[model samples]
Target: MKIGELARRTGLSASRIRFYEASGLIEARRLGNGYRDYPEDAVQRLEVITCGQQAGFSLEEMRALTLEPTGGANRHERLLASLKGKVVEIEAMQARLAQSRTHLLALIAGIEGKPVDISCEENAQRLLARLRENDEPHSQAT
Candidate 1:
């Protein structure tokens, strides 16, 4: 199939297909007339690339996920392992984000609870103290 047909079938632009080729995530052959020719299985490969990207895989990671390497079992194992690893990474990121959010909310509370008559410099000092306290070993929120 030509790039146009591939793009139509995959719902991707021609430039995107060309970019995948440039990134080494997909391959195309130059025909006698110099137009890029894709194999029938290119549709499946492009779908895998898109799916992997949607799941937060980098183009480098998608290359591994989409490549048709020799030894079918190795390919299957690699895919499964990569998926599990990605899940773990996402969980860790979620936890860190949650912790940071909690710390920010606490800081907001401290600032809001300050006395209305206090000078700005006094409020700043109070916030610095709160920060130092939060940064202690047992109280560290993030």
Candidate 2:
């Protein structure tokens, strides 16, 4: 079918389909009239590409999975290994985000606990001091 039909069937824009083609994710044949002709299997391939993208697979990774020769034996194992690695990376990112949240909450608490009796400039100075203290490296008592 034509690119327009393929776009409608895949629920993707024609430009996106064209991008996938240019990215080497999909293939199309040029007819005698210079119009692109796509095979029926292209629809399923596009679906797989979409699913991979949703799973956080980069275009390079997707290309590796979809285009590499796997010897037809360990494809599932490879995919599982890749997924496990991604989980570990995501967990590390979550840990950093949690630390960031804790630090932000502490800063907010410090700001809110400032003495109301002090001038605004004094309060600001105290906050700056608190931030500087937090930025300093404390020596652990061994």
Candidate 3:
């Protein structure tokens, strides 16, 4: 099929397909008429590329997984490791976000619980001390 057909089938633009080809993520053969021809399997390859990108894989990482040789063994093992590593990174990010959220909620509660009798300067000092005490944002979410 041609670039247009591939783009329609993949829901990607022709330029994106060309960019992938240029970036060595996919390949196309040139016909005698100066047109690019693609095999049926190219559709599957493009799907995998897009899906990998959606799953947080960079173009370079996608290129490595799809292009690099893994010694003819169960190539899937390398892919599996990469997927697991990404999951770990995502989990760590989730933990950090959870802690940050807890810190924000704590600050909000402290502000709302301020004693009306206290002067502004004293209230600020109290908040400041509270902030200093919880500076790490390490509070665990229940």
Best by lDDT: 3
Superposed model 2: Cα runs more than 4 Å off: 117-139
lDDT score, candidate 3, position 48:
91
The weakest ten consecutive residues by lDDT in model 1 span 63-72
lDDT values for all models? 0.88, 0.86, 0.89
Per-residue lDDT of candidate 2, residues 1-142 (tens digit): 9999999999999999999999999899999999999999899889988998887788888887887664665888887787887789789989999978977887688678878789867887887787777767777433
Residue 31 error for model 1, in Å?
Answer: 2.2
The better candidate by TM-score, 1 or 3, is: 1
Worst 10 residues of 3 by lDDT: 133-142
Runs with alpha carbons beyond 4 Å of true place in candidate 1: 68-71, 139-142
Model 1 clashing residue pairs (backbone) = none
Q: For model 1, what is the C-alpha lDDT against the true structure?
A: 0.88
Better of 2 and 3 by lDDT: 3
- Name the candidate, 1 or 2, with the larger TM-score value: 1
Q: Which scores higher on lDDT, 1 or 2?
A: 1
User: What digit string (tens of lDDT, one per residue) describes model 3 on residues 13-96?
Assistant: 999999999998888999999999999988998999999999999999999898876466567888889999999988999999
lDDT of 1 by residue, 9-107 (tens): 999999999999999887899999999999998999899889888998999888766766656888889888999999999999999999889888877
Which of 1 and 3 is ahead in lDDT?
3
Say which candidate scores most in TM-score.
1
Clashing residue pairs in candidate 3 are none
